[model samples]
Target: MRNLLVLGLALLLAGPASATEAEAWQALREGRAVLLLRHATAPGTGDPANFQLGDCRTQRNLNQAGREQAQRWGQLLRRQGIEHPRLLSSRWCRAQDTASAMGLGAVEPAPVLDSFFVQPRQGAERTRQLIEQINAQPRGVPLVLVSHQVNITALTGIFPASGEGLVLALPLSQPARVLGRIAPP
Candidate 1:
């Protein structure tokens, strides 16, 4: 298992989508990688002008499709062999909602996963912190970080669509290797 995961991480671009996602799933299931997921289809670009943390009304929230997508993510992951992951989410309402809707387990708010879109200046620092945190995660534990596109892009250089997931190997290096994209289910 370790050898396959290591090989997958080393040559992430060597295979097709299904093979890539399969290896990515193996890494995730074995606690050798993480799923950096963007929040589900919150129908809007950014938050309202008066957006504030901790208040759902102030932010652009998940639409019905987004909610269902999140639920489907839960079902898909469970079916793919991940039942209860250490779910961490940004403080945004949409992110929290996505995490909650997954029904996998409890959701913890990690500041590093917060969106820095409106506050671009914070991206470098937050990304650095997020990388450090991910590096510190126990090697044998699966984790799921629910965040925004900005955060995901900053860490992985992948502009993920809403509800999309990128599987990254554990102990991430300078340039993170995205093992695969976990398409919305």
Candidate 2:
């Protein structure tokens, strides 16, 4: 009986951390936060030397499992009450495909969301530009930005896995605060 009670107490203690994902989803659904999602698995690091922004064949596109993972993210968002988020994506094929696979509404290409992997010097400038853009936007609806891991890390200071999302409270006057992260379900 004592062991049972201890186990129950432990489970209770672990509840809040586990509940953060749900809470993050709720925050996003309410338009009180923004979601920055790293593009789903592309099965490779950075694009190939021959990569071209407009051609999926030339870029490291999403593999089969990655595609399914992206779809699952979409379903999770829908289940969490974010039916129509303002979706934005990097111009790269992988980012664009991930955003489209989310089944969210039309995705607008945001150049600032593009990967800075090749041009590391652009990271700081691009991060600043992205923050400015988000600050200028009216936060009346949920916003999801599908971008590369480098871009996401630059903005949030969290190196996210592919298909992972970081929920952030956007403060116009300062850097965004990361509320929580939601991994692919």
Candidate 3:
């Protein structure tokens, strides 16, 4: 299985940028994988002090470039025939918008994926909870989590930029490992 994953990663990276989404989709379709997506290109750091959860105007929302990237990522998924994925996201507006722009399906607001960037340091407990969530999914179907940079970095050990994503193959009785990263087309 590991060998297969390495081959897949090689193929993905070898292909043109426009092929990233399809390669990622194929990987997800073939394994019990979890997709950890960094929020789209919101050109800023943390949210403001007065940021509200639901109100986009009050939060650090996605910019025009971010929105286009998000939509394009979704389009790529659709092009690759990925459907009915279980979508999850951080409570932050940027993460939520990134997931929503996929237009794939209902996205659950998962606090486990919330950014630890605001905290003095990273939160291990929250990251563990998220890992548990991914591990708890039933067999079959793919899981996608749209989250902040700190949260994704804590989980995957790789700091992905906005709109970038990691595909991790999770075995039923073993730990999960990163397969490859998917950059926007």
Candidate 4:
């Protein structure tokens, strides 16, 4: 059974490594890579038991430090001259608020990008769907996903703290590969 599981995991990672990663500022300047970011720093870890999908007030939210980090990251992006890039977020409140604080304009909720903390039922399927979405996006305009640590880690094997971001190059017809990371600047 363990062998079978290991094989399965191996196959999962074998997907085409086609993304080109770059530093946050560099990616913004390049204007092409997709940004997979763990939501801005929150006070605690994962959402609380009472956390509700619809109400952010009920959840452990971004503290001043987290909010400031998000804002600074956004400013960095803007300074790089990327006025607008497609922004998507996990439905979690922390993720949503993180995107908002970045001053990046309206953020679309993507359930597929939700955290896999509680044993996400269809992890592989969800990741594949998100990858397809990223690939389908038009070239030149950056794609950004504000989500949770688990989600980002599961997808890229790169564990990130809140406010950390990964720039990925996903060219249509090619596979997506990890390029580089966007650490707090």
Candidate 5:
């Protein structure tokens, strides 16, 4: 099974940037994998100088297109058989907004999913904590984590685009087994 998963990852990495969402669905159907998603397109690059934890006004928020994109992602994910997934998000407004906007169930705040762009040093420890948590989670329904590019990259070594995601197999391997990428809706 591990070998087959590795082969899938190799094929996905070699394929086009247009990630096959079907591949992600197949991985998630096994019930032992999770999706790590980058928040939808927020206009600017990082947060503004006055970024705050719970204030959307103080952060780089999702544009109109991004909002629509999140809605479409919700529809698409539901269409793909992940109805009411256990969705988690970063405490940041943008990440939380993206997860909430998905309408994929309750959005739980996960501090480990917060971006480490400003404080690069915290990436490793936070990623470790996230991995520990994920590995410890009891498998059941589909799991989705809406996070920033920096945090997702730290976990899977893939710099995901806005709204893009990677399906990762669990137990927390050294280099994560990336089942496949789920492109933006």
Candidate 6:
């Protein structure tokens, strides 16, 4: 499609700083990075007024394109030799669906990855909790966390597009550093 081509061109034009895409993938494969990905395209900014976490109908579920995009991301990871990373997702339906579509192993619900759109004050708290969780993760184990835009921004200071991911180097003693981003073609 024209849109996908345009997106690919844009990503190629706006490539990651210093580190190339290959290096980013290598870092991920080596388990030296953590991937924080925004949920795939849901065709809306936020959930509806009567949103309920238990029901997918009440939430903004992913469209066909979104589902395909998630599958492609999974394939990309596999191609990069990251077959079965520790997958975590927010409790929201959209996030859950995106994680499942990744074809990765079982997805564990992480409250720390929950969106703070309605309640802004929780963003910082949840971000801190997520950082602590990342720091505690066992070394040499890759991690992929699927969350909302707000949560991702709160954690990494990067606003990624739908299905886009930011690779971070999370050191145990120091703060997490953004290494680069991965936008599948």
Q: Whole-model Cα lDDT per candidate? A: 0.90, 0.86, 0.79, 0.75, 0.84, 0.83
Between 2 and 3, whose lDDT is larger?
A: 2
What would the TM-score be for candidate 1 when compared with the true structure? 0.89
Stretches off by above 4 angstroms in model 1 are 1-17
Q: Write the per-residue lDDT of candidate 1 for residues 1-185, one digit (tens) a residue.
A: 99999998877756576686788999999989998899999998999999989789899999999999999999988998889899999999999999999999999999889999998999889888998998887777679989999988888888899999988987776568888887777
Determine which window of 10 residues in candidate 4 has minimal summed lDDT. 15-24
What TM-score fits each model?
0.89, 0.92, 0.81, 0.78, 0.86, 0.85
**Which residue pairs come into collision in candidate 3?**
none
User: What does candidate 5's lDDT look like per residue over 97-157, in tens digits?
Assistant: 8898888888999987888999999988888899899888878678898999888888778
For candidate 4, the clash count comes to 10
Best by lDDT: 1
Lowest summed lDDT across 10 adjacent residues in model 2 is found at 170-179
Order of the predicted models by TM-score, top scorer first: 2, 1, 5, 6, 3, 4
| Each prediction's number of clashing residue pairs | 0, 0, 0, 10, 0, 0
- Per-residue lDDT of 26-114 in model 3, one digit per residue for the tens? 66875467778899998878988887777888888899999999888788777766676889889888888999988899999988888
In terms of TM-score, how similar is model 4 to the real structure? 0.78
Per-residue lDDT of 1-185 in model 6, one digit per residue for the tens? 99999999888877754346667667777788888889998998888999988988998899999999999988888887899999989999888898999898899999888889999989877778888887788867788989998887777667889999988876622335777787743
Indicate the worst ten consecutive residues by lDDT in candidate 1. 12-21
* Candidate 3 total steric clashes: 0
Deviation in Å, model 3, residue 75 alpha carbon: 1.1
Better of 3 and 4 by TM-score: 3
Q: How are the candidates ranked when ordered by lDDT, highest leading?
A: 1, 2, 5, 6, 3, 4
